[model samples]
Target chain A: MNKKTPKSYENMLEVKNLKTYFLTDAGIVKAVDGISFSLRQGETLGIVGESGCGKSVTNLSIMRLIPSPPGKIVDGQIIFEGTDILALPENELRNIRGNKISMVFQDPMTSLNPFLRISTQMIETIRIHQDISKKEALAKSIEMLKLVGIPAAEERIFNYPHQFSGGMRQRVMIAMALSCEAKILIADEPTTALDVTIQAQILELIQKLSKKLNTSVILITHDLGVVAGMCENVCVMYAGKIVEKAKTDDLYKQPAHPYTFGLIQSVPRLDKAKDGKLFSIEGQPPNVIDLPPCCPFHPRCHKVMDICRNQYPPTVDLGNSHEVSCWLYAEHKELADA
Target chain B: MTKYIIRRLLGIIPTLLIIITLSFFIVRVAPGGPFDTEKKLPEVVMRNIEAKYHLDEPLVVQYGRYMFDVLRGDLGPSFRYKDHDVNFYIFQSLPNSMILGVIAISISIIFGISSGMLAAVKQNTWVDYLSMALAVVGISVPLFVIAPVLQYVFAMQLGWLPTSGWFTNGDGWQTILLPAVTLAFADFATIARLTRSSMLDTLRSDYIRTAKAKGMRSSSIIFKHAMKGSMLPIVSYLGPAFAGIITGSVVVEQVFRIPGLGKFFVQSSFNRDYTLIVGVVIVYSVILVIMNFIVDVVYSLLDPRITYK
Candidate 1:
């Protein structure tokens, strides 16, 4: 922000009131309602949410990769490295994508071009950003592939995507994303399509490589355990808004929003022996189409108050930068005034 | 790939045999022989004529004899055309038909791919609507109607071309222009519609999104990533289409007054010239089979996932 002169330079990314809407025959679906967050260098920020909660949409908005026609970013300003990405021209914006910032998608099977060799896909990504020869670009691609734990990466790079296993394809995806030493990496459920063991390996590879490259990461996933292990800070999104934000440890110790509380509770606790039944949050996520100006998680909140139904809750700051948008978190005097 | 082609070429023998046998019998099933005439010849003269052409022999023996001749690459004598064999007529017209067909297909590919890609990339816009509307007209109107209409406009009304003829002057290729364009019109429409839809589907694919996400130049994304996938349908179609066009369209040839294999195909049937009819069929079948083989090879090249084995 113009007001925070010095701190803005320190932050890697700043998303201000980002809202992405999809215009359909039924209505305007606010896939990502007004939400704000920031990421800093070498810090992994996890976006945790159930399906359709705008975790992926928010990142896609950052990348400016939302498919047009039906999809549009209604209101948003994504500031990266002191420049407004939303206002930048196409030529300028392209330099930011896959160079300054890159993303890994959810499904590895469909994410890659099947007809092309891994070398072609990787070299294309690398050569677009840097003015390198094809041979050099291919060499860099093989290096990145090897770094991501692919065996015989030099030979394998020439093979088509279909020839690779699911886990190997995801590894290639990561290698392509990190090939250029991008400042920020966005991984949208990168491990979702893989089995449990492969998922851990990919997550670990991402963590290890990004750390070595000193790349800040915005990791979007539904797995709280992944967040607990991998993220320094975490955001809990419900419907299209971030319901809570805090340091991972502190949030685990004390979840401020009922939705966050429900998410943490729902996870099977390894510390406890044979629980009778797993805890689950009641009610489905609100339909985002023409959604009301109120708390989206209100229906499922245990402490749902009258104020939550008609009015959106303001973000309440608990000490040490922990924040929650909940009527329950409001001070009695503030509640009375409203 | 070399081995596959060799095996495929060898495999054509049995297929050609079946086609030759079927045509040899089916032509006989029709009424009247090649020698039939309204005025009955004297019995002695007719028997002498029948014996000369082996028509007096049993049908099986004649078929065996014809098969023996065909094995040595001879198509036997033409019954109607004096002092000619089936091979001579076929080989003579083939180059003329091929020249016309090649020109037609070249026009179709160039116009079809560019217009179709434009329609797809600029979908729902005026460019899309205009090109698609033209394609619809092309597909709906048949060659017989289209050729004359084209001739009417370019030749009669505009006086830009000859009315109907091949090589108006000994070296005049201007005659080929009208007919080739007419021949290409329908196929252009087919290719355009196919390319438009296939490109649309491929453009929406996850890989295309990844290409965009990688910040690829729009031209590269389209040509490198989207083009090959969209071309699959068109490549598969090109085989049979080439076979049909190379032999030429009967209506296309007739309306334009051009000599092509299709003319022979129509006349040989009417004349009940059994050997000539079978020879034409053999040419069309060989071209069709060979074209399909080329398509499969191209498929493997375009999509690494495909393998002949």
Candidate 2:
């Protein structure tokens, strides 16, 4: 990347050869295979994929947020701001979390404590990594709520989670996540559980906050439209690997990988010809617990080669910050070989 | 909430009536009368004794009379405790029992909840092991055993506290410590175990994870998020447990030589003191009812999901 890159950008996060596996009772499940990516400062790197495609797991690995016993990062280098966070001590990792980085989860209803008023939850979080008094914490919380575009912030702070709608609860979650002014915000499908209008509002809030704070974001979602609308850089994940990465416009214009093309085509496009059929990717994603020996997506790739069935394709550069892992481009054979 | 509470209040009628009727019959059928003794007395004297107490009457008539007396705020005289009315004996002993119960419940709840939470947060550590070990001991060792052992260790061997009685005199609270601790020992154990398990469950909730994700401190997550959520189960256990504590273990009272209600209860039971035994049973039943009612109310308060009805 350094050899070919223009020198105007600095990466906020760089994850290399990250493998997060779950030591389940049945077998070892490689939730995140050997995946590598870099997010530049203030960039919205959208990780778009189906459920079980390891997008969420990748974000969790970056945050060191995986619940252990079953889930473990067996091998990885999650370098945030020149520090390998995976190797950091527990105490230091905690400081990095919610200080340098914060995460917003899905299901706002279950995510927020129903018994507690929003003020109590938000203020306590402010006080955790800050030495502020209760009054200061409270003020900061209200400020955050206002920043998230919550109306009547002062009155809403005292309301319980049940009193708020799903959209409002999610806004509150986003507010709490942003309260620490984290450098990298990992929002795992933050709006998936809300209505479409609310989803738009939450995405807009996230986009506005990212710009305002200059926070690099890893937006993990399965919706291609979400990635298209909000993210500048998109990582198309399939079965625990990033199969394609590029500038969103370039990828949408000319998808290099067969899987990426299939994903984009599968969605109902308004620009499609009248009576044009919606494309569908055939077959379910390969089961992680007992996956095949070759490329996990080979069975469903439209441009599957003989080699694709037996050997995994190394990522190939399509030039100008675009990369695709596929055997379709023969001229890039040397890149795959390397 | 008012409707729910009113419905629960209405439930108490059948509960009390059943307890009264059961106590009446069970006390009567327990193989001995209050007048039973080894020495024989003159026939006329025995008849007079039986007639005065209405002991010679039919069982149904006796039950009716007992219910009437209870309704009229009279529990009758203690046939065994020569000089005292049953109410007098109960009133004399109730305060000491309540004190023991309150102290025991308070200590148990505070220590148990705090320790359980610590154990959950710092799970698999020494603190967790220590708290769990205490729970195991509390559950396995009966109060009868714990009371005597505590008395011997704290009173006789250590000499740090008094050995027996509710008070040094009739009013001063100087000598009640040993007995209170003895009576409370098992209650503490039960509460600790319940609190620990409930806290463990609460700590595992998704909301707790969410709180942590929000950058909430471990202390706040445990106290505000987990502890409050765990209260419903602990509250449910509290009612029955509180009644158990207030009733005072008869064996513990005897071991500590405390002239509490538990001591009176044992004496009455042994001598087949019909009116006294019946009176004690009725009093215990009422305590159980009131405690359960309180538990229901507390349950509704702690969990909005629960309704008293």
Candidate 3:
């Protein structure tokens, strides 16, 4: 299925109808089933989803870093800088990995090599994508570390990862991710593992660094608060598909899809009365390995209609760059057109 | 680090003392005496031999005498090999055994690590299967069986290399080859299996994925990132494995007829040569203690988080 989107120079990265599937012993797992989105230059796009909704898979696909044998991008176009990254050779993709597009992972404790010192990891990452001397790379590494608010970075650089605390390790990861001056940074749940206070600090650091470097970012997370605070645009995903996409403010103000609406309402609000019963989305996420032919969310959707069970909903643009994929919107669109 | 090494060295003294005390008593308690041969010597001749070595004295006196000689850096005379002292036999034969042990261990580590890495990197493929299959064979079959089979194939049938006997001169490696291979075969398999499993675990670690995300080459990731962590298990194993291999050489020595400490050890045990038995045991204990100490030091080096305190 060719679902290619027209190339746009204004956008730094456009993932057009990407499908990353895992051929496991049980069955085929549609981890990222035909999701599409674009990031404009210097913009932060948040992909908010529950566990196993394929948010992380989408980012891995963009980097072509998915482990094979069990996983493969069955079809897609990852257009970056007007070139389809999916079609590029392995060697060419390697150059883009940390050079033009870098990533920060969730668990900072395991992300940095334990045997290597902080300086070694950061300097090596810098030298991989740039032609620079070891001394120059070391200087740049320490500079990046200091920029991330790390104290005593010059001395700390010589210490192994185990010497760093959880917050400090995340800072180092960020420094390494940004050391190459990448154009787009993909952070997969970067703050999920930190404390609430540290989470806010890490988010602020990422935001400040991205703005300073003028680098686009794809921040994958399940916390709406993080998205609302740091991201300019947000994509709400469910069962490996984008169910809602809008400006962060618009998404918080008016969630179109039932899933997105349920997610927002589930969050404990301070303004609400002190009630024991919190709003929760009923039913579990559908098994991606054996997903239904129709809309995967129909089983759990509160406002499910007749067509929702028999057919997949088409994505409908609701003007002002807001989009929703739900039968309710589809029906509304039909009535409006008629 | 130097303090740690010194502390570990000092600890070996009491350890060695305890080992020596136990082995001394245990050997004395066993049924046979040093002069109890099938062809008995005259009673007067036997008495003279026992008296010369202070064996006729009371057990407590004999123990004190032995300890005194040991403190004076003397292992006493061998009862079996007359006119030769215990130290003479040990010093004469230890170098050959050390050469064999070193060669065997080196071969085992090099082959084991490489094969294990290949198996892990190509998991579930033919290379992995073949290497694991060979490793299973190596581990299951006894070294005695391997020794004869190798000698039969390479020496008797093929006639490519000498069957036994070590030579110190140039190109003596040919004579050392079969015995060393036989001695190392099982350990090689053990290390290979250990490395493969450890490497598989290391390869799956999040840091390896992080390395890949950094655009580091696969070779660099495997060698620099995965290797150091994976080596922890192998290093721990090598300490005891080194001592085991040295003692295990007794069987290989018999099969190959190579003159080494293993040959002396077996002969001394059978002949009830008290001084010789204790001397060899002490030497083996020293090697073992030092090796384990070295392994601990290497462990800290591989993983910097480990400190001596």
Considering every candidate listed, which one attains the maximal lDDT?
1
Using DockQ, give the best candidate's number.
1
lDDT by residue for model 1 over A80-166, one digit each (tens)?
888888888998988988998999999999999999999999999999999999999999999999999999988999999999999
lDDT for model 1: 0.91
Q: Which ten residues in a row have the lowest lDDT in candidate 2 chain B?
A: B165-174
Better model by TM-score: candidate 1 vs candidate 2: 1
lDDT of 2 by residue, A1-338 (tens): 23222333488888888999999989999999989999989999999988999998898788777877679999868777677888888668778777778888888888888777899888877777889999999999999999988899999899888888999999998899889888999999999999998899999999999999999999999899999999999999988989899999999999998888888888887888478777799998999986776778888877777877876776788898899888676455453563
lDDT of 3 at B148: 88
lDDT of 2 by residue, B238-308 (tens): 88888877876677667766666777677887888777777777778788888887887776666544544
lDDT of 3 by residue, A29-144 (tens): 99999999999999999999999999999998998889887899998789999889999887788888888899999999999989989888888899888999999999999999
Instruction: Kindly list the interface RMSD, in angstroms, of each predicted candidate in the order they appear.
Output: 0.7, 2.3, 0.8
- Per-prediction DockQ comes to 0.72, 0.42, 0.70
Superposed on all Cα atoms, the candidates' RMSDs to the truth, in angstroms, are 2.5, 4.4, 2.8
Give the TM-score (vs. native) of candidate 3. Answer: 0.93
